[model samples]
Target: MAKREVRETSELRAIVDSCQTVRVGAVDEEGMFIVPMSFGYDWELDESGTPRLTLWLHSAGAGRKAAAFGANGNAGVDVAIEMDCEDGVITGPYACSYSFAYRSIMGTGRIYPIASGEDKVYGLTRIMEHMAPGAPQALGPGVLDRTAVWRIDVARFTGKQRQPKA
Candidate 1:
């Protein structure tokens, strides 16, 4: 089983853009909790002209997930795309002969709840654009009041790929 690490930013963005949901892992006094959430993101230059990847996620105003965020902001996120299993290629009759092909990105980041109404709308717009391209872009103020939008400032991330042997 040979695995390859993807180092190019283009490849990483490709994997992220291809996925609809991100699996976020958070921990609190109780324990660890992982939730699959819809998200939107953008790669832009910061004030110092350094490239940055910022992710936007949203959830109900109150929940276990939100509680985890309130208690602790640090989290681990994973996005996977292009997954498939290859079977019937085994020369010998064994389960180990099968292989899976996939591309994934995983990393740790800090999740901060957006407090400003304008920022919330911006985040929600990005999320809607990614999740539903043709959907309405505007988010009502009342809707923003009920929803909690979060921003994940990715610190460091790595991408990996597993290709089925020919």
Candidate 2:
């Protein structure tokens, strides 16, 4: 079994879409911290029509994760993100021949808090759409104020996977 790199943008997006959570990693005065959170994603086209990926995350209004995201400042913090879907294991004649099948996307980006109320609503909407599609998509009063919404503009990302032998 061998690991293969998924180089196409569509393929990378597919991998991300298949995953439920994203692990965000950051560093603070104490040390490095990583947390897994529910996420939503979107893709935009640049001037050259290249696809750009942005991830949305939410949490309580106050916490270590919010601080690491530069909640109080306009400047954002650097973050590393990873998301994967386990595809199950493959059995072979011998232990050495077995391999796991999975697809993963890993990247680094800048995470910033969405300060505006409207933008926070937008982020929350995306998250709800992804996590609970077909459910009520309405936001009640004070929901935006109580929740912390974050936007991660992916600078660069790559996808990789190992497949079970046929």
Candidate 3:
């Protein structure tokens, strides 16, 4: 596989931090499926002043991700950040479409399955906090009992953006 590419550093981290959900792309023997998923960021700096960002995602006992990893351990993913563009040039028979603002992060990495109970709970809590920051959060008593957290250890990620010029 070819090496991952990053157009800019600051732009990549900024978009990832601001965006809520990312479309995780994976392919299986059946076909390719792009899943819109949420993640938690573990942003820190390395000794050399490089930004280290990690995304945490979870799933129930058995889910599509499980099958995707089973099919290919070396699977990768692509995440996208889009804008809610209102009042666009209504073209064609459809209402409107906006491809003006977009930032996508794509890379190759191996998905690490969570085996520890603590890690699973932590991942789940992160998800809850992300979804409803102020709302009263309550996961059923048996959520962790049945849930399994799968963290995507993104080996390398880069951002591609399209924005208006000054």
Cα displacement (angstroms), candidate 1, residue 125, comes to 0.8
Error of 1 at 78 (Å): 14
Model 1: per-residue lDDT, tens digit, 1-166? 2257887677777777777888888776687777888988988766875557788999997978887775543343332212112222424368776656677777877788887988998899889988899987866658988998988887777778776456
Which of candidates 1 and 2 reaches a greater TM-score? Answer: 2
Over the stretch 40-154, how does candidate 3's per-residue lDDT look in tens digits? 6566778986766666777665766666754433343333222121222323445464234455566655555666788877776677676667776566787767766667666
TM-score against native, each model: 0.80, 0.91, 0.69
* Residue 154 displacement (Å), model 2: 0.5
The most accurate candidate by TM-score is 2
Residue-wise lDDT of candidate 2 within 1-166, one digit each (tens)?
2349987778887898889999999998779989999999898778986778899999997778787787447788889999999998988899997888999998999998888998998898889888898999888888887898899999988889877567
Instruction: Return the lDDT, model 3, position 64.
Output: 66
Better of 2 and 3 by lDDT: 2
* Candidate 3 Cα errors over 4 Å, as ranges: 1-10, 70-99, 134-138
- lDDT, candidate 2, equals 0.87
What would you estimate as the lDDT of candidate 3?
A: 0.61
- Residue runs of model 2 more than 4 Å from their true location after superposition: 1-3
Residue 124 in candidate 2, Cα distance off native in Å: 0.5
